[model samples]
Target: MSKRTTLQIATYGIVCLAILLVPSFMDDAFILNKYARYLVLGILALALSLSWGYAGILNLGQAASFGLGSYCMAMALKLRTVPVHTGKTGLPDFMVWNNVETLPWFWEPFYSLTFAIFAGVAVPVAFAMLLGSFIFRGRVTGVYVAIITLAALVVVNLLIIDQQRYSGGFNGITDLAQLELFGLTFDAYSSSSYYLIAISLTVCLFFALAVTKSKAGLILQAIRDHEERVRYFGYDVARFKTFAFAVSAGIAGVAGMLYTIVMEFASPTFLDVQLSLSVVIWCAVGGRQSLLGAALGAIIVTGMQGALSESEIFLESWTLIMGFVFVMIVLFLPKGLAGAIESLVDRIIPEDHAVQVKSRAAASRRGVENEAGSP
Candidate 1:
């Protein structure tokens, strides 16, 4: 492997090791739970990086998939909550208060934990597929895509809030039971829950890394840089875009489910426009082109946000402070923190090694171009 590739692998290894070791050093359940949520947000950032960074498809409504998964898991866990929390008919308290006589037909399947878990991922993938079919196949691109996605998110958020009887309105679903699997309980405040989030984020980060290194991933990036050229090269641009979008949605869905577990509730705010925008900022701060960078960006930003919000002096100005930080980063580090670090590392590497890596990259680009130009 090249020096650059080796460095990347080492970076990933060190980061993963640090994450796995966090629980070992932190014994406070509250702190661990907070970190777990940050990790879950990291997964969401990774999802955005996969689509926006790699595929060049900026989905402003990414939280829709996340919120869907959150509600799906919340529904299952709500059913498992203590009987006292439910109505006489064993319906969610919100549904009971809204006078839901029987569980909606759509909600029946969520009673099965297995099905709920499956749906948490499946539903988002399906939604992405459906939306992508129209957005991509219709040849939507650039800011138009962003507008459509944002509009879709608003619609979904409104629907959830309007259908309070079914969706629990703006209040969302709460009184969730601890997640039970294989006879083990995952309490929100327990170490086990933190591990679950960490493990899930690790799996997602690696999975995304693998995807970006695959043949299809190369084509996706090529399309991102030159969509027309890729289409001329006989590649189905729409298919690749849709596939990336769907994969992003699936990962976001998984993050959402984990969020539900950590927070012990599902709130419409999970689908809020602000949350989706925050995700984009996380990806930008971390270096969208790098999965590990994006994930770490999310974790760091979220941790800072939590700390700032808790500080008596900064509590009221934390949002503005974060905005200023983002602007500064954009101005000074256009490629983001990851890119800046990579540049520093490149300067420290032997000149010969750097030249070799650049030559190989140029050769690879030529090879791709030559292949595309061939009959």
Candidate 2:
């Protein structure tokens, strides 16, 4: 491998090691739990990077899938806690208050933890496939895709808020039961929960990295750069785009479930437009072109937000300060922190070597295209 690739791998290894060592350094369960939420947000950033960075599909409503997953897990956990808090009806407190006579058929399936887990991921993937088929097959692109997604997210958010009888409504589902598996409970404030979030983030990071390095990933990038060219090359550009969209949704769904586990509840804010837009900013600030960079961007930005929000001096103006930081990054460091770091590394190392590497990669791509064009 080239020196650049080696350096990237080393950087990723260091990040993984740092994440694993966090719990060892921080003894406070509260701090660990807070950081766990940041890590879960990182996973969402990774999902956006996969779709926006690799596939060129800018989804403004990424929170829809996330909210779906959160509610699915929360439903199961809520059912687990319902009996303790409610009467013989076994309905969620909100439902009981709303005079729901019977457990909704839609919610009955979530009574099983196993089914809930499956639905948490599968529902988002299915939704993405359905949405993607329509959007991509219709040849939607650029800002139009963003608009459609943002609209969809708003619709879903409103629907959830309106269906207070079935859903938790604006209050959302609260007082969730801790996840139990293999006779061990995962408390939101416990080390086990932190480890769960950390491990899931690690697995997702590597899995996404592998996908970006695969042949399909290369084609997806090509489609992003030149959709017509890829189509002319006998590739189903829409299919590839849809597949990436579905995968992104699936990853976001996993992050949602993890979010529910760490937060101990599912809230309508999970599907908010503000949160979705913030996700896009996170990807932009982290270097969306790189999965690892995007994840780190989310974690770092979120950490800064928390620190600022908690500080008495910045408590009221943190949002303004964050907005300034984002503007500065966009004005000067358009490629983001990761891109800046890569540039600095290139300057410190040798540009000649990097140029040669890029040249060879270009030549290889040409050769592949030529082969495809031939009989």
Candidate 3:
């Protein structure tokens, strides 16, 4: 690997090591849990970076996929608390409140932790694939894609709210039990949960980086820059878009699952349009094109939220602050924070070798000039 690549890898390794060691350094459970939440949000930002930055797909419904995964995990935990093999006994509280005498057929498979896990990833991917096939094939692009995705998020939220029996309506799925993974109990707010989230976030980041570096990554970038040119080059642009969209949605779903573990609940708020748009803002603030930027952006936003939440007087000002941050980043720091940092470093690293280059050029010009003057 090149020196730059090696340095980057080493830096990332050090950061991961530090994060892993956080349990040893911080005894505060609340702070530890907050970091876990940060990791989950970072995963969402990473998803946005992959799709919007590299693939040029501004997905506005990522939160829907995320909510689906969260609901899957939350429901699974809820299932574990109720009686087993008793008809409708394992039904979630909201279902009982809604007079759902029988468990929904779809919720049946999610009773298994493995099934919930699969559903978390698969459902979002399948949905994205279905939508992409139609949208990309029809040559939909730009704002139209964003609008459609936004519409999807709104529709999904409405659907979930309407299905009070199964979805918990606006109250959402809550009072989740600790997760059981292969006979191991994963208690929410536990140190182990923090470690799990960190590991998952790292894995997602690595996978996203791999995807962006692969051959399909090249084609995706091409499509982003010139879809027609890619199509004319005999590439099935639609397939590529669908693939990227599916992968991104899968990543978002994973984030959603982790987030449910952090918050111990799943609600329509998870699928809110604001949630989806917040991710876009995160990606933009972090540098939409840089994975590192995306992660940083998430951390920054989450940290700010935590800070603001502590101040009752400033609670209402948080949104305004976020808006200001977004506008400032877009106007001045086009490359996002990571991009800006890189530019600054490049500027600071003076090109001493330029002296030799300039000397050679000047000598060559002087030699020619001297010869011409003598003649």
Q: Which stretches of candidate 2 lie over 4 Å from their true place?
A: 84-89, 351-375
Clashes of each: 0, 0, 0
Clashing pairs in 3: none
User: lDDT per prediction?
Assistant: 0.92, 0.91, 0.84
Candidate 2 lDDT for residue 279: 96
TM-score of 1: 0.92
Residue pairs whose backbone atoms clash in candidate 2 = none
Give per-residue lDDT, candidate 3, residue 199.
85
Which window of 10 residues has the lowest lDDT sum in candidate 2?
Answer: 82-91
Candidate 1: worst 10 consecutive residues by lDDT? Answer: 80-89
The order of the candidates by lDDT, greatest first, is 1, 2, 3
Q: Model 2: per-residue lDDT, tens digit, 1-375?
A: 667767777888789789988999888999999999999999999999999999999999999999999999999999888464465438888888889888999999987999999999999999999999999999999889999999999999999999999998999999888999778899999899999889899889888877887889999999986788999999988899999999999999999999999999999999999999999999999998889989999999999999999999999999999999999998998778888987788678875767769967986987797689678
Better of 2 and 3 by lDDT: 2
